[model samples]
Target: MQNNFIFFFYLLAFLLYIPTLILGTFLKPPTKKQISPPTPQSILARIKKGSKYTKQALEDFEKLFLNAQSCDQTLWLEIIKEFALSPSLEIKEITSLQEKLKQNNPNLQNEIALTISVAIKERK
Candidate 1:
C-alpha cells in the first residue's frame, strides 16, 4: 500500500511536470515593437490637407521641429514655403503668422527668412 501511494505521488508529479515542460517548449516570450518618430513629409502632408494653417497643424509642426530627432533642412524649408505660399492667407496674414512662428521658435529665424526669400523669388 505504501508503494502504491508512492507511485501515485510520482505519477501526479510527472503529469504536472510534463505539461509544463511541453508548454514551455511551445511558448515564446513577447517581443517589443519599436515605434518610429514622425517624419517631415508626414507633417507637411497634414498641413497640406488643411484648408488653412489650423492651430492643431501648427502645434504638430512645432512639436516635430522641437523634437530631438534630426530632419533635413530642405524638407523644413519646403514646409515653410508651403505655409508661406498658402492662397488663403494675405501678405499681412502671412507676415503675422511668420512673426508668431518666430516668436514661438526663435531658432527658426534663419529658416523663416529663407522661406520668405524663396516665396518672394517664386512670386516674381
Candidate 2:
C-alpha cells in the first residue's frame, strides 16, 4: 500500500512537469513583430495640413486680430462671426489667446488675435 501511494505521488508530479515542459517548448517570443523608435518621417506623418474650415478660420482670425490690434471694431466683429463657426486652431495659439482674453475681456484685442490665427492656419 505504501508503494502504491508513492507511485501515485510520482505520477502526479510527472504529469504536471510534462505540461510545463511542453508549454515552454511551444510558447516562444514572436519573431515577426519588431518595435522601432519613432523617426522624423513618423513625426511628420502625424502633422496634418490643408482644410477649408481651418483656412477660413485662420483668415478670419488674422483679420480680427489685426483689426483689434489696430482698434478697428467694424472689421473685428464681422471676422469674429466667421471664425466662431470653426475654431480648430493650433493649441499654443489657443492657449495664448485664452490668456490674452482673460487678461483683457470685452476689449476686442484677444478676439481679433484668435480670429486671425484661425484664418492663417486655414490658408496654408
lDDT leader: 1
Candidate 2 per-residue lDDT, tens place, 12-112, comes to 99999999999999999788978764332222222223233455445444434433444445544444434333335455655464455435545655655
lDDT computed for candidate 1: 0.70
lDDT of each: 0.70, 0.51
Cand. 1 TM to true fold: 0.51
RMSD of 1: 5.6
Worst 10 residues of 1 by lDDT: 61-70
Cα displacement (angstroms), candidate 1, residue 21, comes to: 2.2
What's model 2's lDDT at 46? 26
Clashing pairs in 1: none
| lDDT (C-alpha) at residue 80 in model 1 | 70
